[model samples]
Target chain A: MLDNLQLLFVWAPVMNVQMILDGVFVGAVFALSAYGLALVWGVMNVKNLAQGDFVIMGGYIAYALFHPLHGMGLPTWVIIPILIVVAMAMMFVFGHIVYQLIIKRVIDQDMFTSLLATFGLSLLMQQVINLIFGPEVQIIDSELPILTAFDSFVTIPTVKIVSLVMAMALAVVVVIFMKTSRTGQAIRATAQDPRAARVLGIDTDRVYAFTFSLNAAICGAAGVLVSMIWVIQPFYGIVYSVRSFCDGGGAGQFAGGDRDGVRPRSY
Target chain B: MKFKSLKTMVVSAAVVASVSMAGSAMAKVEGDTITLGSSISLTGKYATNGLHTTRGYDYAIKVINEAGGVKVGGKTYKLAVKYYDDESTPARGAQLAERLIQQDGVEFMLGPYSSGMTKAIAPVSEKFGVPMVEAEGASRSLFTQGYKYLFAVLSTSEQYLSTTIELAAQTTDNPSEIKVAMAFENDPFSLDVREGVVDAAKKYGMKIVIDDKLPADLSDMSATLTKVKALRPDVLIVSGHSKGAATAARQLEEMKVSVPIIGMTHCEAAKIQEKFPKAAQGIMCATQWVEGIPKRDSMFGSASDWNEGFKAEYPSYSSVPYQSAQASAAVLVWKEAFEAANSFDKDAVRDAISAIEMETFYGDIKFSAAGNNIAKPMFMRQIDANGNYNLVVTADDMQFPRKAGY
Candidate 1:
């Protein structure tokens, strides 16, 4: 019994620390993915079931820019910002087109129909990506130096550490934009009470578009970060989608909302 | 005049033999592109296996195409691959098989990482009459299905479980009356593997101490580990997905139990190296393919090139799944057969494929009438401290008849 107690005392904390760190590292990526998903869900009130697919598309974009184009003598770091912008713009157009064609009509319909419809869209998107990319895992170009190691047992990856810093900064920027920018405020107002915002002469349609575009931009950023750390494939979107919902803590809840009651209302 | 006439007659006979050999060579297909289709788990839970296998195929294909593809029947053709994610679901796998056959118009197919998925996709291959070269998953029933279109590159589940048991039974230190315990996930694939282990144990005169199906999604494996510890079996066998496999290993380590774990399919590939790096050491598992197992070159020089290429990719001593590499070789073989048959007709291809003595990456492949390869060999590998598997004993390397018991 005493031996058992000694073993527990020695190993429990070590295991806990490992789990916690893993959770944090995984959770950061989750938070970023969720933020993108939440924006689409919160504003459009139509869950873009294909949100994860868009993330994978962004990763593929980065892969193409890095390789093949490497011969063009463009530095990978310099090309990343341009890739992110292009991914965001492409996804924005994709979302707008998808919403306009199918989701906009079914916004007030049965939730089941919306779910099925978006699911079909997701499948279509997955097939498209598979056709183009051939269902392969494309490796990232970025190589970050290792920051530290504890006798080879606990090594801190330099890329992940940098990603944590970048993620936090990105989060702060998004929060600040939501708090200050007029379009952002209008979108927030619409999310809080669309009927009320509509009465206040703020165009809810435009706000929806702006919110979706913003969500896509965030997703593209998350994809860029992920591409740096792990090999990206066309089907990674589904995993991202699942992890995003996990990090959201609950369905239809906002993790980014502040204490000042500036919460985005979700359907 | 009589001596000159005799010389002319001998020369004519030699020329006739040469013409027959040339005729066979000309029958082999050497098209511009040799299309190989893969229906793999790309999107769902088994994505890791599918992704790695696909990567292996891609890397292998790229290397082959760069070398101007396989030269057979006096022509060179490039390899073009069409692949789809089966989503790790049997239904999806079947659908993908149909799509690959009907839409992609591929000559050969490989993939479906689990046994159930492979079984599901087998019918599609049969229906379209396109030859399929399976990788990773294996079930005895697949070969028993009597389909002419099916050819398995990997060994059957029986071979894997039986090899592990055969290995465990020979442990010198634990030579008490052998008590075997079986813990596996509740799935068709894992169930088939457990059956194989049970059969092996019974055959070897070992007592069944415990046999239980752990839950399919057993995240917390403390209870299972505790039970295993209490049972105190001489040998404990585990089979399932990686998550459960790792959980079992971790819990066992935490409990300070020193029982040797002979693992099943869940611990087969390179992924286990990452999940249970410490526990993986000394844990034995049976597999049809291992990149680490050094073997002599067969009829295929291209197969050796793939081995070199894979070594360059993950120089960190990672275990490359041998079956996927075999599938890449199967693509080359199919090209050879297609050319030999000189027709895309299913029966013609099947006839030609069965007749040819295929020198594949896994070695010489000769199929039985049921389309199952008669010589599908499996290796029993033990993981080293560096998380790489070493082929300690293969079916070929086994000390004949018997060794000291567990």
Candidate 2:
């Protein structure tokens, strides 16, 4: 460990830049998923343990698209962003169905009940994914050339840069949507109090469904980035769920509210 | 509508529970069939190699059954394995072994995948006094346990990639000045492989550089590669299972971290050459058996013949993995032992397995007192530009200073 510290600090200090680049690439993925978790937990008050599974599910969609589609003589850069959008739209619909079938019932129950329900959903999604995709470690190779710096010591894949920009762009779009859109206002109103929003003529059920679906869409976008950069398998979801909660809780605390009321306002 | 959905879920859960209970109550031997139980890594981290080992067992079973089956006590008995997914965890492996013996009523046993898995199942099989011949799981510590009921058909893990260190020493003019970097998984199999490398490196008075224990998931190691860039070691050796090989090959290429000699175990099992042909070129891969091993039997013909048959069965493979070859060989050992014993008695089969000395397409299968296949020697093969593996026996056979095109 000491030798490693010395090697990084003394022998090859330039490698520090390479390590940080790797962190930024992975961090972008975590941030997107975290934002999704913050949205759902803040709005619906549903402790979604299956949030990570949504990310992995979205990654599978990208894998199904980018892998076979690219083989049919299509370019990667053109297909990647399009697949991300496609995954988000598909997951939004899936989340709506799930909300109707499962989440809608649990919303009236206590937080513990919602936790148990989502935990079961997480397990169900994992096994279903294993059956569909098999238990192999899959990656959607973007085939984009890597850029190098400082005499090739600091290497960066072009896909990671694209994923970072995509993540930032998605974040900006979400912030703007939450701030100005009429549906976004209803979502915040419902999050503050469903009874109050209902009295004000906002359909609380519709607002809850929209908020949950939006969170899934954001997670789907993060998952597309994961496919381009790292490897994904069925059982790797639990790790992502943990990170999402961490980022969500951290973001919540930083905004100074019980359930991050200030951040949910800017959701 | 909600009531109907909940009712459907409840009924499905009941059906699944009942089906699983029925699945465990299979017979050991019934109506001209001999059942051997095995807990394989059908899911989890080791799933890739587990599938290869399963194919090996299944393909061999098919060949043996077609070739008049195993003739024991004047009755021909078809061989079938009752497999349970151990999920690449030791605790699960042990539980499945007990369940295979107790609930499944399996008298004879086939080995699970990997040394860690075998270590877990061995104790359970030994307690039940069931004779087990395993193809995977090559840790030397397994052989030291004095397991009379256990027999392994593959060379120990210590011999897995130690040959690369010797080759490195031979290729270098200054053997004493050789530098070695190792990244082994924190599992029993890889840890033993690391010990063998440390011994080999010591003989040449080599300097030990970066040594990292990869997590069980074997997910990310870009940090290790970053260290490799700064240190620039003469030799880089890695061993973890198939996932480890995939992660290493993926990151090594992505980072463009090149070394003169880089050796990794399970490259064939992972199909690194086929998946990432450019990055995998010139990388040395260790194997238990190859097509050109110059061995044959009437059952499987020659090593090349077995290779052809396996590729025919699983046509997706560009090259056959040694894991499958050794797995098929383990099944052959069971057939031989069952015939030699001429009885369905567990102790008779155990004695038969211990006294066995046979030759097949996978190579010579003879067990030592400790129950490891001391007859076979592990070989190192270099993946060529076209993704074909060519056996590299000596230092000169290697393409020095690996050029993994960044």
Q: What TM-score does candidate 1 reach?
A: 0.60
Q: What DockQ does each listed candidate score?
A: 0.07, 0.53
**Which stretches of candidate 1 lie above 4 Å from their native place?**
A1-44, A50-192, A201-267, B1-114, B172-188, B201-259, B262-279, B291-298, B301-306, B309-319, B335-345, B355-361, B394-406
What is the lDDT for B265 in model 2?
Answer: 95
Misplaced by over 4 Å in model 2 are: A110-112, A251-267, B1-26
> Candidate 1 on B300-392: residue-level lDDT in tens?
345445566666765642556664576565665566676788765667877877886655666556777776666757777766667666675
Among the candidates, what TM-score does chain A have in each? 0.83, 0.93
The residue pairs that clash in candidate 2, if any, are B138-B157
lDDT of 2 by residue, B271-345 (tens): 788767767988999899999989998889999999999999999888889999999999999889889999889
Q: Look at candidate 2 and tell me the lDDT of residue A219.
A: 88
